[model samples]
Target: MIKTSTQNELIQYVYDELAKNASEQLETAFMHDEELAESCSELLQIQNLLDNALKSPHKRAVQNILNYSKSLSLQS
Candidate 1:
């Protein structure tokens, strides 16, 4: 069984977004807890899907910004 604290810590661990100590704790928990490991794996998949979705919108926004800057530079 995974402790509540360990399950909660998984949010950061899924993305490797935790500090060193917290990340280490997550790793230790995962090693000993099968349910937490499965949960973390699921969270990781969700994170990856979110990351992929964000990339397209981010690229579009960056391109828009670059186009706007180019237009402004031409005006000046």
Candidate 2:
């Protein structure tokens, strides 16, 4: 099993948040450890998915906000 700290490092590495030295060390570990390398690959895939995921509010949510604003304005 991977250590918790190493798992955290994997996340940081995936996000490009790891320090240069630490990143190099992790890469070195990756060459010898297939599990660690696979974990990193999975994280990269998830990060890519999140980066491309829909970011806007739902249409219903926007309409609800607009309706609430109109109601408040009518009371004022």
Candidate 3:
């Protein structure tokens, strides 16, 4: 099993937040640890999926919200 600290470091590495020295150390570990490397690869794929996901609500949803607000304000 991977240590919690190592798992945290993997997350930091995936997010580009790990320090250079630590990042280098992790890379070295990857050379000898296929599971670690696979974990990193999976994290990268998840990050890419999240990055490409739609950011905004659909226009119809927004319009419905606005209309609801307008009706409430008019009733006030």
- List model 1 lDDT by residue over 31-74, tens digit each: 87888888988988988888888634578888999999999999
Candidate 2 ranges beyond 4 A from true positions: 56-76
What are the Cα lDDT values of the candidates? 0.80, 0.96, 0.96
Poorest lDDT segment (10 consecutive residues) of candidate 3: 49-58
Over the stretch 1-76, how does candidate 2's per-residue lDDT look in tens digits? 9999999999999889999999999999999999999999999998889889968989999999999999999999
RMSD each, Å: 3.4, 4.4, 4.7
Relative to the true structure, candidate 1 reaches a TM of 0.65
Model 3 whole-model lDDT (C-alpha atoms): 0.96
Best by TM-score: 3
Tell me how far candidate 1 lies from the true structure as C-alpha RMSD in angstroms: 3.4
> What does candidate 2 score on TM?
0.70
Question: Over the stretch 28-76, how does candidate 3's per-residue lDDT look in tens digits?
Answer: 9999999999999999999999999959989999999999999999999
